[model samples]
Target: MGNGDNCNPNWKDASFSYYKYVPSLAAAGIFTGFFFLAFAGHSFRMIKARAWFLIEVLGFAGRAVSANQEPGCWTQPPYLVQTLFILLAPALFAASVYMTLGRIIEVVDGEKYAIIKRRWLTKIFVCGDIVCFLLLGGGGGMLASAKTNKSAFDLGNNIIIGGLVLQLLWFGLFVVITLLFHRRMMLSPTARSYQPDIKWRSYLHALYVASALIIVRNIFRLIEYCQGSNGYLMTTEVFVYCLDALPMFLVVAWFLWKYPGEISGLLRRKELYDGSMHEI
Candidate 1:
């Protein structure tokens, strides 16, 4: 693969190199399988989480297909498919994590302990997640389609960085809120928090683990984009798998092992008990 002309005419004059090496089909396959497993695990219980996992499945599948193509010989469609899907998939994962924290707060009846009201916690964070999603997806599309226009490519990279920075800020705020709630709950536990059936603390711990991994991944990406296409991070295929792929897979696996369905079940039971009390 000599650096002469790209197979796609659109990228013929583009300075950007899509991949430094052939993308690893094995890596893509493994990650895709893990995501599918997570999706199946959550499908019957946590429908919303399952939806996000489904998108991850599609993203890694696209990556696998893109990997099969030789570098510098990629067509426009495959390039866009891989770039856009892989770049945007983590945002969806973040959305699920945000909702999990909201569910945890509800399960513990820790509304007063939380910095943000339980009713608004998911809404605020998920809305921020949506904005990050659009910024990332739109920026990725721009980067992929910029073609021969160097200025356009730079612009796209800048947009992606902006999105990443915003995501980091939101994640930081989320962690602070979770810690504050955890501290308050410990100092003055709610009645529900004492219930043997409610494992809210364990769930909060899981949220911390998940959120930390995401924050690390986002920081890696922010650095990668800031370093530009020819930077070491982009030139090395190993970093993507180790930093982005592995961490994200662990996140899904963690959620599967510590499923949020328990919280949902507890909430349902609480609603039923309250209804019965009202009738009495």
Candidate 2:
């Protein structure tokens, strides 16, 4: 551990230096506000879809508070709170994405075209997400509390990297399943797929955009963690905002612009469709 004079716990006593540069209050505040708008603007019909926005709101709100503290002060609670929340928020975002695809399949009555059975689609991806979430959340907590213990810190970092790898694999498979379903639907279109009001294509496009952004951000994080605390990514502050925060913000914006509630509405209207669909 490094030495410090007056701080409660010497800054050097922390596992890692908290921030290379002071986090920007303005950026954190803007992100928090937008996420709050997303959470509040969603309709009652969109309750399920709106869950992740609340996580983002809390995550960025913690970040906003962390931004006001002295740089490199790892002793504060907000530092750990913001770090863990921000680290884990994307898993929730990906959960909504998984459910959205299942809803989209239902909306188009394209269960037959889906690579995975519609019943299993959300279940499979969400189970994987839950595992990833636990690893990430657990690993983050362990890392945060592992102050001055190099062995504990390395173990936690490895666990986080494992979680990230699992997430990437699951997400990549999800995209493949989505693309295959899209292609099959195009080749043998269902009657519901052609309905003018449903706009399943638009929603699929939005999912593609959101998935791409999340994947890119995850890759950036994977690299950041792999590089370790003293590495270039950790020493630089801009990458966090540029790669992680900005991508997530755009994801929320894209979904807000192309809301997924239509899928839920259509599914509600044709409740029988989900149960009775024939599999090929």
Candidate 3:
């Protein structure tokens, strides 16, 4: 259509009106950080036990980015702190994930989870996560560069599909594996301390919610990508806000405070949560 405008692809089309709502958005970021902190913190035990913790953390970190919205909303005071929370979120989520998986493999022995122990699976996971991280990072960079050059949007929009697909695939596989584990456990009665399929499904449901939010926001990139190369996707500020910023924050907090660890000691008992065949 018209010539591309200069702005970061990250903020989408957030403009002067975006400024009007900056305070409100920043406030929401504060609440989101606190709410997620509990999820992130309380998940420590599960993180320790599971090999896929990094994937979970990155999923949440992406949500935290949604919470940040834009710098216009976080110019000063509490907003700055909130902004820091938003900015630092993805990295922390990544670190937590890395640490969680590494800890599980190291402490319990990687062989414990045969599925995870597969060299092929590990390679696939590592590659997929790297791609997913790069895609999200590219989006963030484009958003930042949007403050300067208009062309960076091209790279940002292009990388998203590959990343989203890989991320979603990994998450789907994760849900399936968890579901299978639950089904097996259900067939046996010895798993008294194990987290029932309910709790496992509940956690998976929460993770899916987070992934779905990011997936929705990322879809804007695809729309922009399809508009013809070198097209500016951020120009559609209305749709971006409605689809990406607004709805992306609608993650359910109900399960955060009441999960396997807090509600049941399943996360606390590593072997119990391991498999249906027997406790690890």
Candidate 4:
């Protein structure tokens, strides 16, 4: 129920954090985009690919904990729904990871691998994603608990931090592997033609925007965790929502929207592996 002597003037605010509302709103926005894809992108094979991320919309959730005991309990509904979302988020995230890898393989490897090997890689990636997701989900669910007792709250905070660390590790590995594969393909003469298929430069802009949103959101979350000793996350719910949540969701939606054309073309002709910038 106190400000807890924030170290910096910037941390002076004692208002409740926007933990609950922001995330819930972002989830809704993501779901709306998913619904659009399900209906509009239905005919395209990439629809299945997008399905992986669409399902992820349900994963956005958080709790209304008074970090280090700030003020009143959450004015919203019970924390149960947020719990479910956090627990389920890892699974959805894993699905997206698998989808991303699968799409990349289709673009880079093309007909190089036999059916068995291709299928094997897909399964292996998916399995790895699943395992990682489960680890994240279990820990993430604990994060949404908002334990009131000081000891319990601190424990929950630690769980969240640990989960974030694990997520960064796993995601970093995937990003590295994917980028290397993309680079190798683009450089190879055979795969050069596929460059046009990638349309990466076109997609890169959207990716940057979406990434900025997600990265900022995650960084903000990390800041909350760093305030370990008498932390105060949801300071001024409105500020948190405006600054971190809505922007992230909107960027994500736009990113997804950019894919329908490229994905549809790739699925129709399987030409993602057959084009390049010949003159450049």
Question: Which pairs clash (backbone N, Cα, C closer than 3 Å) in model 2?
Answer: none
Ranking by lDDT: 2, 1, 4, 3
Order by TM-score, highest first: 1, 2, 4, 3
lDDT of each: 0.81, 0.82, 0.42, 0.47
lDDT of 3 by residue, 202-240 (tens): 554544555555556545544654563334553433453
Better of 3 and 4 by lDDT: 4
Winner by TM-score between candidate 3 and candidate 1: 1
Model 2 lDDT, residue 21, Cα? 56
Error of 3 at 280 (Å): 18
Per-residue alpha-carbon lDDT of model 1 for 110-209, expressed as tens digits? 7888878888999999999999999998899989888668898999999999999999999999899989989999999998889888888888888898
Error of 3 at 261 (Å): 5.1
Pairs of residues at least 3 apart in sequence or in different chains that clash in candidate 4: 16-234, 17-234, 17-235, 193-274, 193-275, 193-276, 194-275
Give lDDT for model 1: 0.81
Encode model 4's per-residue lDDT on 1-280: one tens digit a residue.
2334522223333222224222344434544455445435433534554443433233332232223223333322324444445334444534444454555455545434223245565676567656645544555445444443555555666666665565555455545555555465455535523556566444434444554555455556556666753456643445344544455445545645665335445654555333333333
TM-score of 1: 0.90
lDDT of 3: 0.42
Identify the leading candidate in terms of TM-score: 1
